[model samples]
Target: MNKPVPPPRLRMALIGCGQIADAHLQEAAKVDSVEVVAVCDMHMDLAKQAAARFRVPGIYDNLDRMLAEAKPDVVHITTPAHTHGPLTMKALAAGCHVYVEKPFTLDAIEAETVIAAAESAEKKLCIGHDQLFDPTWLDCRSRIAAGQIGHVRHIESTLGYPISGQFGAVVAGDPRHWVRQLPGGLFQNTISHPLYRILDLLPDLHPRVEARWDRTKYDFPTELWVQLRGAEITGSLTFSSSVYAQRVTRVYGDQGMLEVDFDAQTIRRHTAPKLPGAFGRLEMPFRQWREGARNLQRNLWRFLKCEIHYFSGMRNLMAEFYRSIQQDTEQPITNAEMLRVTRIMDEIFADCRSREERVEEFVPETRELEVVR
Candidate 1:
């Protein structure tokens, strides 16, 4: 009998050559079935640098030229948030599956249009909500599915950004940066990370949203607080630039709680102690030590396997996306999920604007005034 045939390799190309593009390229290299055929960027120097680092043969300063010349089967759009919608539509039109980096689009309307284009083109579309695929998050989901946490009651997602970080500094220095032009300003560029967590755990697709925006700690409004309520669960999201960089999500269930720390790549499960009163208090430290030991062992194993890097989640997501395209299976992230998150973000920003306007109206003197020397 003849052996079964293997599927042909896939040709992948990247459209943006920014810092995030390196993560995409490095992760793509781990997928055995895909090849980095080309890279394109508005800045030719950035494109050339990426090609040289990844050993990609084709590089171009124009998307049309790269699409025509490289003939890639998949294109990864890691450009700024504003360009996501148009670039995705163009890639789908060019007969290529697309993986768009997040803040999927500026608004839900654009998200709907781009997704429709991908559907019309009959190609797979994936978003860069890779945090959901992180090892810690994966373990948390598995534990929840196994009834370790019972029914979830509430979720809190927090993302802290340091204003001194590379990207943050860029935005701070350039008054006209693309992020500043976003409706939600800097928050629009990052809130998606924390927001996606709540949307995934909450059953409601259209949750009621309330938001407050403030800039007490920075020249621009770099802090956001959002509250969302679904049918059975309530969630809150926090994005702060004043705080030290941290990424954490906590899910509280009837029986216990699960906390995932993205910055440390660890998860901790909490539950009521068997002992009562003072005994329970005494047992808490021991329980924490056990949890820490478990996390250490798990991370050590992953480290030995060379999977302890920052972009491990991206690698998993990219592999799944490529496999979906190869086998004609559903994409890892549903179009509905993408649209729901976008819509919620839109509602949050709208509320934030209204609140800001009310604040300005109530306290006219509080508004910034030009100081004369």
Candidate 2:
């Protein structure tokens, strides 16, 4: 008789038990190829609680000890930004694939180090830029690529939120301890997603930091305006954490434009004329009226209920990770792409620090035109 085949060996560990760790746990539970064998956190109690909550067999306050004993196939690093680089290197050295949270490191050099370690260890490294996996983003990208919008000329991406004092207070209370330590504030913490997504859609694009400004008086910069120059296109990115609550992206091409309101699960397309002529510049009366009505309805609907149409792209993100592992292929959001994004962010932060500007400078000025009486 043939010898019994041993069970497939694929164990995993969670390196941080913070709020986002729950998102990791929820996604990991849905994947069948791996088992969560252990969890580790700087706080022993947090580790134990997470292990119990996830029904894992091992728990430790020390990451090194956990790695040595658990010998997990993958280690998810949801720790603070400062710890991400070191924790990732340690896990990679121990022969474990790493899934680090967004803004992989505090700076580009540190991010490069993590990338180098992963390359040397011959293990996979993925960053959590989940917005790239959103259904609306995917659809928009597909349409743009298929020439539905023709040659891409430019793009505009914006994200913001409003809660000044309360927001700072919440960040201060978090003992995970690194948010306060990081050099850049909301720009690094929040806006990195849109900055990266815009690049992902236009891979050949090389953005030059034409201008950097800020306006908020927080400990770190809260807004950024970046201009990117590609081989044949130019784009602008505006990111902030100051608006009451708004997140929207628009991509423009020679033929048309695609607008995505991910928070509202709506996609709007404005197609240009197929042939240029005197009538080409004329706006179709019915189309204009329809668009105005649709915009009003969407705003009113979203105002009534905050969570009505928000599309959580968690499922797609998980699927991509699993597929990357199975196919042994580079993911859409590869380590290289992540490093590029980090580098751009690092440059922005450096520019802001060197210039010593206030956050309000980065905030974009919009005409306060009334949409409703």
Best by TM-score: 1
lDDT of 2 by residue, 129-206 (tens): 887777667778888878977988888888765535565457645634456567666566776777776787666624
| TM-score of every prediction relative to native | 0.96, 0.80
Candidate 2's C-alpha runs over 4 A off are 1-9, 164-168, 172-177, 217-219, 272-312, 357-373
Candidate 1 at residue 74, lDDT? 97
Which pairs in model 2 have colliding backbones? 214-358, 214-359, 214-360, 214-361, 215-358, 215-359, 215-360, 216-359, 216-360
lDDT of each candidate versus the true structure: 0.92, 0.75
lDDT, model 2: 0.75
Instruction: List model 1 lDDT by residue over 1-373, tens digit each.
Output: 9998878879999999999999999989988878999999999999999999999999999999999999999999999999999999899999999999999999999999998888888999999999988888988999999999899999999998988899999998888999999988998889888999888899797889999988864678888999999999999999888889999999999999999999888889899998999999988888989989999999899889988889888888998998899999999999999999999999999999999899879775554443321
Please give the RMSD to the true structure for each candidate, in Å.
Answer: 2.9, 8.1
